[model samples]
Target: MSYAEINGLSLYFEGHGSGPGEPLVLLHGGFGAGETFAPVLPALAEQRRVVLVDLQGHGRTADIDRPLRPELMADDIAGLIKHLGLGRADVMGYSLGADVALRTAIQHPELVHRLVVVSTPARRDGWFPEVVAAMDRMSAEAAEPMKQAPVHELYAQLAPRPQDWPVLVGKIAELKKQDYDWTSEVATLTAPTMLVFADADAVRPAHAVEFYALLGGGEHDAGWDGSDRPAARLAILPGATHYDILHSPLLARMVVPFLDAPA
Candidate 1:
């Protein structure tokens, strides 16, 4: 357990395992803390140092006055990397955290060695219409039901201001209502990336393919010799859904090999 004062935020993170290669930074989903990755942490940390971060307003990190935005959070992540003196690290994020990780790679390409984006689309419209509608219904009132959820239970235990859950819910609701499109930015990302999604996710499968295409993947077949392969990779886990994919052991199985691949 550790805290780094970066960008006026008390960024909380914990380092696990110690092995060779660049450290891997794991960012959790919205309303979730670093502990969200507990299921896969052991497998991931086995081969390299894994740093689990509690992004702003989640877990041990208290909420700030600013609205929750991926671009700003990305900057905080970049600053955290610099503060830790890791120089460059592999970053992986799920859901809300994936947005921040994607932005971090886009905004601070030099600081990210590689990136893994799980269960997030490059644009707001990529989500299913039903999912978008659900997001539109998010509000402080939704916090009550979520209190019974595991995420909320975890937050209640770890959040510095547990009573502020309603506020966090409202902020995230507002953040989701905002429209964004990162197609152009994603096309220019310099870091090698891997996009992972469940077969049944909030994001449309077509959009997942499109997202991979923007990263210079899935446009062509790797030749017999494999020299024609794109730097980016995509994986759709079978028998998984967005809600449970993060906890699936298959996530580590797919991620570890890609992170270990030659640069």
Candidate 2:
């Protein structure tokens, strides 16, 4: 466990595996923390140094009282990288984390060597307004019950794992009010990229397709293959939902090669 003061916020993070390999940073989604990558860590750590971060208003960090946007979150990651004296590293972002990765690669190109975005749309404008609206409604509905119910009950309702209910609920409650718009900022990325999609995911695959089109270029395939060309690439995991892909070995196989490619 470690914390870094970056841009007026103390960001919580952790690292695993030994050095002498390329560094890989992992960012989680909204209402999640660095531990969201727990399932994927052992494999990734075998050959790469894995850095995991909990974005502001989540995990062990104190909220910096700023609006949540991709740029700001990206800056937090960039600052942590610089502060830790790391060279350019590969970045793996999921959902809200993916948005941060997109923004980081675009705005702080020198900080990231490669990029992977999963379960998140390419363009902010492409996200379903209905999903966002539903999220708002769910949050509103959760408020009163949340006040009266034990945090564990909420976790039993949401997470597959049951040990860290208080932390999860607290993070969810805090980040619920956050919002961001990234439509204009995504085109600036120059890193080699991969956009992974879960076909059964509620998030639109078209968003990932359009995003891959924007970030250099990549192929969109509904099948799973580890090989992709230089510019950019896309792959869809058939029958995998957003949460399902997190634990999928197929997703790991598809992703590792792209980030491990010769630079």
Q: Which candidate is the best by lDDT?
A: 1
**Could you give candidate 1's per-residue lDDT for residues 1-263 as a string of tens digits?**
88999888999999999888679999999998898898999999998999999998999999899999999999999998998889899999999999999999999999999999999999999999999999998888999998888889999999999999999999999999999999999999999999999999989999999999999998888999999999999999998998889878799999999999999
TM-score of each: 0.98, 0.80
**Compared with the true structure, what per-residue lDDT tens digits does model 2 show for residues 133-235?**
6555554335445545433343344343344444444445444445655545556667888888888775776776666667645545434664454467778
| Shift of residue 202 alpha carbon in model 1, Å | 0.8
Top TM-score model:
1
Residue 67 deviation, candidate 2, in Å?
2.6
Candidate 1 versus the native: TM-score? 0.98
lDDT of residue 79 for candidate 1: 95
Q: Over 4 Å off in model 2, which ranges?
A: 136-141, 144-184, 218-230
